[model samples]
Target: FASVVTAAGFSPNAHDPALFVHLSARGRTLLLLYVDDMIITGDDSEYIAFVKARLNEQFLMSDLGPLCYFLGIVVSSTSDGFSISQEKYIQDILARAALSDERTPMELNVNLRASDGELLSDPTRYRHLVGSLVYLAVTRPDISYPVHILSQFVSAPTSVHYSHLHVLRYLRGTISHRLFFPRSSSLQLQAYSDATWASDPSDRCSLSAYCAFLGGSLISWKTKKQTAVSRSSAEAELRAMALLTAEVTWLRWLLEDFGVSVTTPTTLLFDSTGAIDIARDPMKHELTKHIGVDASYVRAAMQDHVIALQYVPSELQLADFFTKARTRAHHRFHLSKLSVVDPP
Candidate 1:
């Protein structure tokens, strides 16, 4: 029964022992859980009673009415839908960072150019600062590129590197930000991907970036160095697309398992027209002959209608933030595109 429901479309993982249930009804097909407790939803009261009776017979059970708190999250009923937030968690992070005061967060600025117009010298303290800023990227994706770049010098940092620590000081003023999951959007899957060519000064290796969204809300994003070196900007961009294609495939599988049906050829946004053209054209041109095997697989998938690649202008590419440094204005603009806003 579990296998059939799961295979056909049901998430037993949702009812897993980790989540506690607070409310359930047979008539409405509503179910909630926290840890081992469960609240089922449906129109049939008798079915709900039967489930309760069965559970009672199998294990000791107590019926709790309405849910105030489950696990570490607080739940409140509303007319539209439920909202979740980690208020306690937010306070704890602030207290741990010793940033209880200073209401407004400093503007995020990671581009720390030297006063003399030279690349700043690296220092050991730079690593520590970069480490802190990297963790802070959980809430501020804007600084991901600069943080990643500064991290490469951990083994040997210079004075110029220490200068980058100022971004951490900036974060000290803004640790309270949190991700908001609004109840006001349809549940649709959308994705965007971008890459920067030869952004690393030392290795000249390009960086790959991708962002995935559900109903216009930023859900997942990543910034990482490419595993293999590519010869051209087009190749790097194709590599990023392949990675994005793989992610979308996995996400589609997971969604299908949860009873969500997405149409074939899901739209994916790409900033490089060269990459888009390479993906759309199945033939191996001179420029595309050396593309990695993974990228080739992605191009094949695009041609097969597994995904559709759409061209996005450079300025509109949110993944641009993931692959390169940007000014404060551009950083804020990308954050806005991700729908992240400072707490009121």
Candidate 2:
């Protein structure tokens, strides 16, 4: 495949082997390959068509036309732009679980502690379900955190743990929910960084979460527990900011490879005033000394103008949804902001 793509005048992307880029004076085209399936896109429609013809000549490949479905995700084109969903995938999951008649809940509740009930007689089924849920979370960010929590007990799942699979039921009601990416959105880069201080009861580690937006549409997001324990909230928040800075830096490079130049420094919003101050100030306080190394990375990014860190009020902090559970109203607000909407 690499030889075929190279022969077709496309160079494979360094970051992703499956991606190929072709640049010419007229325009640029990107080809993404997954096994034998391929998605051809670029600024020049003619160039994209040219690549498609070349691939068809090289291999016995059929042109599926525009990308409406790939893998398990369904893409719907709209006047505004494009929307991606996994409705069919969700229904298939429900059918396999024998939960076709279940009702979807509006909110998710997760208990991270190890279950005290009897262990499942067959843990394989539980593991399989959890694995499937993890994949489904690709288009369903709302379930990311919950699925993360459930995944921890896959090896020794209990009856109590399996019961919490009600999250699947919740998916049944909102299966048509889709993520919208508007065509009019700019390429400006903006991101939100947040942390739930000492969220892990077992090790006292914080949970870090961040989401990056391109022209107000979500393109990247992550929710994971921090590696080291922090003594203070400011330190934890700084760690989260540092992680986000690294992500944004990589994303900026990726955009450049895609021929999208982001001239302005990426904006990183955080809810912690102390963390923001630490990132901006050259001198560090005694309380933050433990995180001096992590702080240095963030400071260097700021100094280089790679990222512009700003303080945001907790109420408007969008990454809050990824770090911790929120009230029903707050969850709905963040979901709306993330452009996760039900089809009309």
Candidate 3:
């Protein structure tokens, strides 16, 4: 069978293969491979071990336990599914900010923003708050937008920036919030990315926002400043789509590594139709030829079957929560949509 399989052009793989068979006393099972990992499940562990032994005879391998950590996320199993977080990371940031004493979970006062009326003579306090909030955003997506906003003025933060520090302090009062990942859902990937063009008063560059989902739960996200200036809102959005596309490509490849097959045409949602059109239309005309190479590269990747792009309305775009400043109500709304909920 090995020779026959090899003759059929399916050679033994040390990493992973497109397909393999598991022969059992009762029946035979099939195994599929992505890039380097394989997902195998059966009713019988003994039979699974037999299959593993046969595969090991042909290649080198290591047996690890169930999936726990990946891409900096820490996962712990619950009766329902899994609890994921960077709680230790959050703790460290709190201590650094001199707020460890405040970690006892408590309801945050939205009124803390009123403290802006009081001026801090030392600007270092503002910088310290921004730094701590930035670190906290790793597990607390609810605070990412607020942190990004405060971080922008860290260089010469005024009483206004200091006022915003109350937002971070308020958030610090709620660090127990976390994102939960239950195992009951199907394995599907969806992504959304958006941008606010020339949002900064100093630099004209746009801000990029992206969110990725594994099934119904968000698994990854980002909100960052664009590296270059975008000539228009469309261009800013295109740049964001490009960034999201790159992330989708890497994620798909990683999923493939785990032997999980993802159908082609991975859907990526963008809020700007112009950006979507830019990604779909390969023609490099005057309006887009000047677009930064980074964005162009993302478009090219989308065209090459790396991922697919779709347009979403700005109002429905969750990525917007990451890229721009919002009022308290909208901030809570978007953060809740991302599934960053209060902890018990």
lDDT digits (tens) for residues 215-256 of candidate 2: 868998888889999888988999999999999999998899
Q: Model 1, stretches more than 4 Å misplaced?
A: 1-136, 153-162
lDDT values for all models: 0.63, 0.84, 0.67
Most TM-score-accurate candidate: 2
In model 2, state the lDDT of residue 131: 96
Which residues of candidate 3, in runs, are more than 4 Å off?
A: 1-76, 86-129, 152-160, 292-295
Which candidate would rank higher by lDDT, 1 or 3? 3
TM-score for each candidate, following the candidate numbering? 0.67, 0.93, 0.67
User: What residue runs in model 2 are displaced by over 4 Å at the alpha carbon?
Assistant: 98-110, 285-287
- With a 3 Å backbone cut-off (N, CA, C), the pairs that clash in candidate 3 are 34-259, 35-256, 36-257, 37-257
**Alpha carbon lDDT of residue 229, candidate 1?**
76
Candidate 3 per-residue lDDT, tens place, 1-344, comes to 45533433333544434555444465444455555455455445666676567667766766665656544456677776666666665565556565423221222322223234445678787787678667666777766766766676676666765644555455456656778766785688889998988876566778898999888788789888888898889898887887888788878876664456887767888879887777666674355777746556776776687777777888889888776556657767776678776544
In angstroms, what RMSD does candidate 1 have relative to the true structure? Answer: 6.9
Q: In candidate 2, list every pair of residues with a backbone clash.
A: none
